[model samples]
Target: MSGVDLGVFARCFPAQAPEPLGRAIADAGFSSVQLNLSAIGLPTIPDAQALADIDLVAVRRDLEAPGLRIWGLSGSYNLAHPDQERAREQTEDAARLIRRAPELGVVAVTLCTGSRNPDDMWRAHPDNDTAEAWADLLRNLGPLFDAAEEADVFLAVEPEPGNVISGTDAAVRLLDELGERASRIGFILDPANLVGETGPDEYETVLRDAFDRLGSRAICVHAKDVVTWDERIAGAAGLDFDLVRALHAALPHPVPVVVQDADPANLAAVRALVLGDA
Candidate 1:
């Protein structure tokens, strides 16, 4: 599935609304899409209420494109939140997608474990390492995993650097906490998310090591690249096709390597790259 059927978020294109975005994604030559579930209507799915607001037209198009059904939702919630009420709200948002996952015809729900900053969903916080942080994460994610189990789908946790479970180690700990249910909850590998000085080349080791430990739980991948900077690597402004090529070469197949992160202007380029036309 890795790069075999490249799909991008229609919203990433930004030129059109939700419906056209799917068409653009299809035109890009991706056979499947890891839908930014939020783009469909729900901002974040942490429950069923958000699912009710989803736009069905986009789903129809994706189905019509004859695109292979991959991840049908992106419920990127910050599971490791500091405030209890805010955390529950986010989870409730994410859960909406989980409730409706079956209808989407996909089994996995991708999510960001979330950072501590309430105002900034993308920024990381220092308390993300404290025991209280861990407790909050466990409390939130434990139930999310429970919901996933009930939904009969897998929850793919993206290890974003700014989020709580930012690496393989953190992910492993979550798995240990959940035990057998961990099988239902897995990692959605994003190589560039770990970017720092050495970036993926450095984190490539992390990726491989993570694969060694959690290969079984690796449900999908986020095909992207990060730019190496002074003493650390940050997410690159542009896409890196080689990153997908390298990851595809290194990992086992059957799981999809979604062609994500394409901007609206270059979405076509991502399609070309994924389909081997580039």
Candidate 2:
């Protein structure tokens, strides 16, 4: 664990102000965080006036003052919206976020691969698997990748169960499509998101295979655990800690493991579990 960083999603402390949020995360024993820019009063797309008006340096100070490192910025948006105009807006916003990341001292900007459901980016729809949906994803991401390359920041793509790029194979295929631009893209491996109603006997095998497929490209890991398709929880979620440890060990480089989708009060316990101290 010498090289690995442990973090929590900054949104977990929704009720607190930026300074208090950072302090709370540090108090829970996390040294890093995946920050939502909005929480710090930074617009995802800062207009010329906003660029001048927003004091990002001060924002960084607020987080760092509490001993929390900003590992990445959450720039999640609907990249695969059925409406082309709406999707274009989302991509442009992402480009803006990408351009501002380096100044914030962030290593990557995490994103949703998106869904065909125009109303809900996380909800699954049949059209998500269609050629048109894939094309839309490619179309939106192409310019976004160019922006990432110019910004020199990595884009960490997360694979949720219900999105255009929902699985390890689809994610790898998208990376392959990007070719050289793929260098700017990384993976956020959330083992719970990868699990899909596998029986008790097959859970470990399923998880190990996913790690084998995606670990090398993973830059961050989400620390939520899943018991079944519908049952996700903090801590181990009934999965073996030994298996999780092994998977982390297999990564080519140590990356931040971020705790997500858990109650704020359980953060300390989650941190301990993720660090193998619980």
Candidate 3:
């Protein structure tokens, strides 16, 4: 079980407080964790926590009984909301996350591509393709990417099923648009996020292509077991861990993976399985 001090998605444990969340990672023998700021009502920019020094002194002292580390902090919000107000708020929030990135020892912050509808962060829409919608996403992210560069860390934009950059191709396109500046905005490739309910053949082909394009940009991935599309809303099967890890291992660059969709009750088991404990 050796990989980037791998950790679980703390947001999976919705019941725990921040301290307990950190403690859970420690108890699982994980060296680090990826905090989901949106899940816990913590925005990255201009938030109260960003304005003041994060009181992680308590977490630092209490969460570690033996050994533990905060690899990075995350504020995964919709950066491309169709509503100007929502986009403004979320874009501003990115700064708050960046402010805390230094103390958290994070080299990058994770983010979502964002939904087309301001009121719906996870729903798919047709207009997400509109130039205006894309412009909105770019208008905000451009500054944040620069800020992340200044922070000396990368801002990883993750592809989601219902967002502007839903698949790897778009992610690649976005990177191409950035040119050399793409180095500032990295990637958090979650295959499941890009995948829809598709046949195994389709899934494999799509995922392989996705990785081929963005593998070099990946800082991390979200490991999850998902069913194929034909299996209904929650059907299909999980890609073999050995296969998943093998795909990641074959990446041009190295990256750690957080099991984003795992259940909290089975963190240790799932973590070990994903990274190949044997």
Candidate 4:
């Protein structure tokens, strides 16, 4: 992690507005942030009206004022929700974000492949592996891909164990299906999400496999530890940061190592662990 760029999830800071939040992240020694519009009281996937309310210039000024910049925009709506209409709505919202990503100076928009459990997109369901779920994902994803193409932004999908794109194989399949449009898609690697219910014994193997298959296309890497599927900051749980750092260092191109699941109190400790400065 020594030569890697370090960032943090902006929402990890408690500030309700952009300026203070940027200050908080900079103070913690991070130079970039994966921003969620929710950090400024707007929906993550805002509608046209809400999107109109955003002041991209103000956001950029506020964040850069504190030496922090927006690296990625969180666009994580459920891409495969059982309800097609609800999923479509989320997709349209994400499309809006993708179109405006350049204005915010963000290079990518992050996504979740989603789940069939109507209540929570993060909860796993048997149907998540079914053909219909795959169809739902593709259907919802098409428009977002178009938006990415038109806006020249990368759609970085994060593989969650509970979602349709649950592992490296699924991720690979999706990329293959994208064909030429595959160039517009990249990945966000968070080793903790790959761990799922598995214990730390699977950490290195899982991390290596994921990188071997997806590392070259990685646009962002999440720094969090796993405790039997639970997520925490680096070194606070079971994940092996040494292996994580090695794989990150081996990436063909540099990507931000964005720290997640950390709050102000422990942010400094996580930063040190991520940078191998601890």
Q: RMSD to native for every prediction?
A: 4.3, 2.8, 3.7, 2.1
Model 1 per-residue lDDT at 51: 53
146-260 in candidate 2: lDDT tens per residue?
8788878899998887899888789889888988888888998887777755666787877787788888888988887764312433322566656777788788888888888
- Tens digits of per-residue lDDT for model 4, 1-278: 55567999988877578888788788888889999888877788889898888887788788868888799998998888878998888788889889989888898988888999998888899999999999889888899989998889999988899999998889999999879888998899998897777767777888899998999899999987764212344324577778888898898999899988888888777787767776
Query: Which parts of model 2 are misplaced by more than 4 Å?
Result: 1-3, 41-52, 227-237
Which is the better candidate, 1 or 2, if ranked by lDDT? 2
Where does candidate 4 stray beyond 4 Å?
228-237
lDDT for residue 257 in candidate 2, whole number 0-100 = 86
Model 3: how far residue 233 lies from native, Å: 18
Candidate with best lDDT:
4
Which candidate gets the maximum TM-score versus the true structure? 4
lDDT, residue 19, model 1 = 53
Give the poorly placed runs of model 1, Cα more than 4 Å off: 1-3, 15-19, 46-50, 53-70, 197-203, 228-246, 271-278
In model 4, pairs of residues that clash are none
Per-residue error for 133 in candidate 3, Å, reads: 1.3
TM-score of 3: 0.84
| Alpha-carbon runs more than 4 Å astray in model 3 | 1-4, 14-19, 38-50, 56-66, 227-236, 276-278
